[model samples]
Target chain A: MKARLIIVVIVLALMMVVMLVPIPYLSKPRTHHITLDSQRYEYDPGRLEVHQGDTVIIDFTASDVVHGFYLEGYGIETRVEPGLTKRIEFVADKPGKFRFRCSVTCGSMHPFMIGELVVGPNTTLYRAAATMLIGIAGTLIYLWSFKGEQHE
Target chain B: MTKIDLLTAAPWLKPILRSRLFQPVLMLATLAFFVMVILTGLFGTPAGNRNFGIVFVWIVWWALLMIIMVPFMGRIWCTMCPIPAPGEWLQRRGIVKRTSGKLSTLRWRFPKRFRNMWLQNIGFLGVAIFSAIILTHPDVTAFVLLGFILTGIVLSILYENRVFCRYVCPVGGFIGLYSMMAPLEVRVKDPSVCVTHTPKDCIIGNEQGYGCPWMLYPGGMQRNTYCGMCMECVKTCTQNNIVINVRSIGSDLTVAKERRLDEAYKAFIMLGCAILYSAVLLGPWGWMKDWASMESVANWLIYAAGFLFINLVVLPGAFALTTGLTRRLSKQTLSTRELFTHYAYVLVPLGLAAWIAFSFGFALVNGSYALVVLSDPFGFGWDLFGTRDTAWQPVGTTLIPFLQTGILTAGLLFAINTAYKIAAQYSQTHRQAFIATLPVTGFMTMVTFILLGLYLG
Candidate 1:
C-alpha cells in the first residue's frame, strides 16, 4: 500500500511538471511568408496573423513616397523607400497582437501609418469580441426576462 | 433657459461668465489664431504636417473640440467662434457693445423652411465629401474658412442676428447637436421672474447687452440645443434671471418633445461619417483611401455617391428596421416615426465616442506637429517660440488600440443604457421597455463591432 501511494505521488508530481512546462520548441516551428505594401499612411494586408512558434518573413514595399515599418514588441523597425523592397525575418515568439507602424516620417497622415502583426491564436481580440457579443446577449436576456419598474 | 430654479452655485463665476467683455475677449483671442490659420494656409509650407493651418485646425483644435469643448463647455466654442464674428460685428455695427438703432442688415426674414438643420447637414456633407482635399491642402483649408466667413456675411446682410450660424454653418450644427450632452447650460434662474418682469429685456436689447443672438428667449428655452452661449441674455436680463447650471451629462436627450426628423437624420449622418471616416482614413484599404483622396474624378464620384448613400439610406434603413422589429416583438403600440426619432438619441453618445476614438488615432500621433507649426505659423522659417525645429514624434502610438477599444466599449454600453431608457420612457411597463430595447441592443452591438473592426482590425 505504501509503495502504491509513493507511485501515485510521483505520477501526480510528473503531471504538474508537464502542465507547467512550456514546450514551445516541441510544438513545431513553421515559417510564414508575407508581402506588405506601405503607402500614404496605410499598409496593405494591415493584419498579419501567425502561430506562436512560427518564423515570419515579410517582404515589404512602399508604393508611394518614403515610408517605414516599425514593429513594436520585437524591436524590428525598417525604413522602406519607394520602389524598393525590404525583407525582414523574425520568430513569432510572442502570441499577441503587436502593431507595426511607420517609423519614418511619411506625410501629413504619416503618424497614422500603422498595421498589425497578430501571433495566434490571437486570444485577446477573440476575447474582446467575445465579451462584446456576450454583452449583447446578456443585455437581451436581462431585458427580455426582467420585469420592469412599476409606475407609482 | 426655462425650468431653472436653482440658485447660482458659483456666484464668483457669474461676474466672469457674464461680463460683456468676456465672450468678445474670448473671440478676439481665437480670432488671432484664426487669422494665423488663414495666413498660414495662404502662405505657409505646402506640406500639411509642417503647415500651421492643417496641424492647428485638424489636429490641435479638432482634438480640443472633441475632448474638451463639446464635452465640458457646451456652446462655449460658439461663444468665441470666429466664423460668425466678422458678420456679427457687421450686423451690430460694433465689435463689443450693443449699438442702438435698427441693426445693420438687409433685414431679410430667414426662410422658415430653411431654419432647420437640413442646410447645415448638406453643408457638412459637402465639406466631408471633399474632406481629403480640405484636410490636407492649406490653400483649400483657407478657401473653406474664407467661404464660411463669406457665407456668414451674406446671410447677415439678408437676415438678422447670426442667421448664418443658426440656420447654416456646418460646424455650428455639429456643435449644437453634441452640446445636448454637455453638463453646463445657460438657463433662467426662475421663469416666473422673466414673466413678471416687463419688456422681456433678455429677448430685446437693453443698455447692458443685445438680445439673444441665437434668437432664443431665455425664459422659455429648455434644451441646450440652440443657445449659442453668447451670454447676451445674461447681460440684458435686469432680473438677473440667467444662470449657467452644471448638471448631469445627457439630460437633454430625455427632452422628448424636442425630437424631430432633421435631428434624427443629423444623428445618422454624423454616425455614418464617423464610421466611414474610421474605415476610409484608418482602415487598411488603400483603394478606399485612393477613392477618398480624389485619385480620379470617376473614383471620387463613385466615392461621393457611396458616401451619401451609406449615410442617407443604409444607416437609417437599418435603424428603422431595428425599431420596427423591436415594436413588433415587444407588442408595443406606438407611432413608428416617433420611435425612429426617439431611438436616434442612442447614437448621440455612441457617435461622439466613435469620433473620439477615431480622433485618437491621428490626434495622438499628429498632435505633436502642432508644436512645430505654432513656432513657425507661416512655416517661413520663422521659429518664434523656438520650437519650430521640434522633431516629429508620435506620442502614445502603442496605447491607441486599447484606447479605441475601451472608448468603443464604453460608447456601446452608454448607447445600450440610452436605448433602454428611451424604451422605458416610451412604454407603459418596464418589461415592455426591456423588450423594446432588445433589438436596439443588438443593433448597438453590431455598430460597435463595425467600429471595432475598423479600429482594431
Candidate 2:
C-alpha cells in the first residue's frame, strides 16, 4: 500500500510538472497580411495561425451580408458590410487558442458561426494530451495494484 | 459503503416526495416555460440568437441538463418534464389532486419486441440528423416540440403509462443511458421489507398516488436507466420500502446482468454525435456546417449518410475490434457479443463528459443571449425585462480549454478504471484482467485524444 501511494504521488507530480512547465519556442515574430472573407454563416480562412509576437493584418470582406468579427481574449471587434473591406490589425501576444465568432445576429445559424485563431506553440493542447496519457497510465496502475479480490 | 437514503438523511424529504402535489406542481411550473418556448418558437424572430426558443431550449436548458442535472440528479428532469404532463393529466382525469379511478386509457399493451430502447435510438438519430435545422429554425423547434407532446398524448390514448417516454422519446434515450452514472437513484431500501409486505400498493395505485408512470417495479429496479425518479413509489409504498438514495456514481454500470445491445448502441450514438457536433458547430469547418445545415438537398443527403454510417458502423465497429482484442488477449470465456455489450458501459461516463465539454464550448459562449431573449421573447422590440439592449458577450471563453482538458482527462481515467473493473469481472486472474483492459483502455484513450484535438487543437 505504501509503494502504491508513492507511485500515485510520483505520477501526479509528473503530470503537474508537464502541465505547468512552459516550453521555449525559437520561431521569430513576423507580420502577415491576409484577406479574411466573411459570408452568411462562415469565414474564409476559418483557421488563423501565428507566432506568439506576430502582427496579424486582416483585410476583412463580407460577401453576402453584413457581418461582425469578435475575437475572444484579444478584445478585437470589427464590422464589415458587403462591398466594403474592413482593416484590422493586432499583435498576437497571448499564446493559445481563441475563438472568433460572428457578432452580428446574421441569420438562423449566427450564434454558431465561429472560427479559431491559434498562437503557437500551442502548449496547452500538448500539455492536455500529455496529462490524459499520464492520467490513464496512473489509473491503470492503481487498478492493477489490487490483489485478485472479487469487487462484488 | 452503504448508500445514504435521502429520506433517512433528511426526514423532510419524505413528506415532499409523498405529497400528491409534488410531481404535478413541478410539471405545471415547467409546463409554463414549455408553453412559452413553443409560443416564441412559432412567432419569434427568424434570427436564432435573438429568439427565446433557440436560446433557452438549446443553450440554457441544454447547459443545465448536461452539466448539472444529468450528472448530479439522475433522471430528475423526467420527474418535472412537461411533455407528458398534459397526456398524463388527461389519463388521470385530474391534476394535483388524485382521481380515485382507473386511468382513462385504451390499455393496449406496448409491443413486446419494442419494449427496449431501439425505437428511442432510431428516434434520437432521426432528430439528430435534422438538428442543425431544428436547432436554428424557430418554427421547426416549435413543430418538433408539438410533435413530441402530440405523440405523448396519442400514446397515452392508445397504450398505458408513458410508452412514449419509455420507448420513443429521442431526448429520453441518452438521458436514460447517462443517468446510470448519476449519484442519485430510486431504490427499495430493504428487499426483506418489500418481500414481506402484502398487496404491493406501489404497483397498484392507492388514493395517494398512481402506479409507476415509467412502468417499472421499484422492487426489481436495479438501475436509474428506466426509473424516472417520479416519486410515485414513495407516495404509495405502504411499507415505505422505496427510498431515494445518494450513492456512488456509476454504480449501475457494474450491473452486468442488465446490460443490453440497444443501450450499448445508444452510448456510441451519443458519443459520435457529441464529436460530430463539436467538429461541425465548434470546429473551424465551413463546408461541414454547410452540409449539416442542409445547404442543398444533395449535400444534406451526403451529410446524413455519412453521419449515420459513422454513428452506426464506424464507432461500433472500432469498439468491437477493441473488445475482440481484449477477448483474444485475456482468453475470457464470455462470447464476443457479451463482451461488446459489457464493455460499452465505459463509454457512459466518457460520453457524458464529452457532451458536457461540448456544451461548455457553445453554451457559455451563447448563454448571454438567454438574458436578451428573456426581455424580448418575440424579438418584437418589447423590452419586458428591461434587458433587451444588453450586448452579446461570450462568458468564460478563457476558461473553456482548461475546463475541457480537466473534464476529458477525468473521463479518460474513469473509463480506464471501468474497463479494468469489467475485465476483472470476466478474467480469472488480476494479470489477465489488466491485460484485457489495455485494449479497450487504448480505444477510450484514442477517443479522448480525438475529443481533445477538436476542443483544443
Candidate 3:
C-alpha cells in the first residue's frame, strides 16, 4: 500500500513539474485576428500568409458558439469563445501550407471549419537573430530550473 | 465414445489452434495488421484513406471481436493489449522513478473494507463522456497510442497483478463484464483436481513463469470478473486440470447466495455508469460540449467532479436508497445499506451489455481504418485492387450510423433482460422491483440514442 502511495505521489509530482515548467524560446511578433462561429471562420483572409522566422500571433474570438482552433501539423490548439478573445503565438519555422480546423463540435458545418497557414522565406535577418536569442534564453532557464534535482 | 461425446469433443479436436499460446499469438498478429493499416491510412495516398474506413468497420471491428475476443478466449484482448507498451517502456527505463519506497513495503496489506467498484464505474463514464470527441476525431488514434504507452510504464513499475487491467483500463472492465455472455471459458476439468493438488501451481506460478496475472484464484472464480485468459495458470498447473470449455450463454448471470458489501456496491456503481455513459454518448444536450470545452480551470474541475458525482455517487446512491425503501415497504428485515450491497452484483451484466452496445457502434465506425493499407501497405501503391482513386468519405455515414444505433439498442435490451433475470434469481419480491426499474433504463437508453444521433448527425 505504501509503495502504491509513493508511486502515485511520484507520478503526480512528475506531471506537475512537466506541466509547470515552460521552455524558453524567442520569435518575432505577427498579429492575426479571427472570428469563428458554427457556420464559418471570419478572418482577414481565409489564408494566413507569414514569413518563416516570424512569430504568428493569432488573436481569435468566436462569433457564435464556442469553437476550438487546432493546427494539425504543429500540435497547437486553443478554444475561441464568443465575445472573448484568446491569444496563441507560435514560430513559423517550417515552410509549408499547414491546415487549421475547429476541433469543438459547433453545428452542421462543423466539419467544414477549416483554415490554412502559408509560410514563405525569412524576410528579416534581425527578427531571426532576436528569435534565436530568446529561444536560447528559454532553454537555459528551463535547464536551470531542473538542475538542482538529482538526475538518474 | 458415443455420438453425443463426439459432438461435445468436436470443439476439443481443434486443441492446438485453441491453445492459450496460440490465441495470444493470433491476437498479436491481428493487432499488428490493424496497426499497419492505421499507419498506412494516415500516411497513404488519398485512395488508401478512403477505402480504409470501410474495411475498418466491416472487417477489423466485427470480425476481430466476434471471431477473436468473444468466441476464442473471452476477455483475452486485455492480456495482449498493446496500449500500455509505451508506458511500460518508460517505467522500465526509470524515466519516472519514485523518490520514496514508503508505499512499497505496505503493498501486501489488502484493505478489508474498501473494494467498491465506484472507481470502475466512474472510469467507464469518463471514457464514454469523451467518446463523442474521441470517436469522431482522427487524432484519437495517436491519443490511444499515447495512452497505451503510459499504461505500460505504470504497470511495469507496479508489482500487483494486472493492476492496470483491473482498475485503470476502461475497455478491460467492459470486456470482463460483457464476456459473461460469451460461451468460451477456462474451467477445471474436475473440482477434485483443484482440491487434491497441494501448493496449487494454478494460483501460484511454477518454474514456467508467473501465475494468473489477473490474480484470479481459479477455485473461487465465479465468472469472468478479472480473468484475462493469459493462460499462465493453465500452463503452470501440474495436474493438467484446466480446460477451455463451452458453456451456456449468460451462465455467470446467476446471483451468488451470499454477497460481499464491496461487490454489491460495485454492482450499483456499474449500473449507474452504464446509464451515465449511454446518456452522455447518446444524449442530445449541446451543453455537454460546452462543459467539456470550458476554458476556466475551475469550471473544468467542477464539470469533471459533477460528472463523477452523477455517475459514481448520485445514481448508485439513489438506486440503493430506493431498493432500501422498497424493502422497508415490503416489511423485509434488510437495512438499506445491506440491501444495496446485496443486490449490487445484479448490475454487472447490465453494465457490460451497455458497453458492448457502445463499443459496437465505435468499432463499426473506426474499424475500417485497418484495411486502408491494402493498396499501399508500405505507402507504396501496388494498386492490387485498381479501385484506389475513390475519394474517402468521412465516417458517420447515414446508413452505418443508423445500423450501429440499432445494434446498440439490441445490446441495451439484452442488458435489461439480464438485469431482470438477476433480480429474479436474488429476491422474489425484488423481482417486481427490478422490473419496475426497466422504465428508468429505457429512458436512459432513449436519451443515449438521441445524444448519439446528435453527435453522428
The clash numbers for all candidates, in the given order, read 3, 0, 30
Give the Å shift of residue B283 in candidate 3: 5.8
- Model 3 agreement with the true structure over B235-308: per-residue lDDT tens digits: 67777666666676666655455355544555555555545544443333334444543435566567678766
Better of 2 and 3 by lDDT: 2
Give lDDT per model, in order. 0.81, 0.90, 0.50
Highest-TM-score candidate? 2
Sorted on DockQ, best first, the list reads 2, 1, 3
Backbone clash pairs for candidate 1 read A148-B430, A148-B431, B1-B221
Model 1 / residue B133 / CA error / Å: 1.6
For each of the candidates, the C-alpha root-mean-square deviation to the true structure, in angstroms, is 7.9, 1.2, 21.9
Candidate 3 segments exceeding 4 Å error: A1-152, B1-8, B11-24, B27-73, B83-144, B207-210, B257-287, B293-303, B342-346, B356-389, B392-457
Worst 10 residues of 1 chain B by lDDT: B1-10
The DockQ values of the predictions, listed in order, are: 0.23, 0.73, 0.01
**TM per model?**
0.90, 0.98, 0.56
List where candidate 1 sits over 4 angstroms from the true fold. Answer: A1-29, A39-42, A72-76, A83-99, A103-114, A133-148, B1-7
The docking category that best describes candidate 3 is incorrect
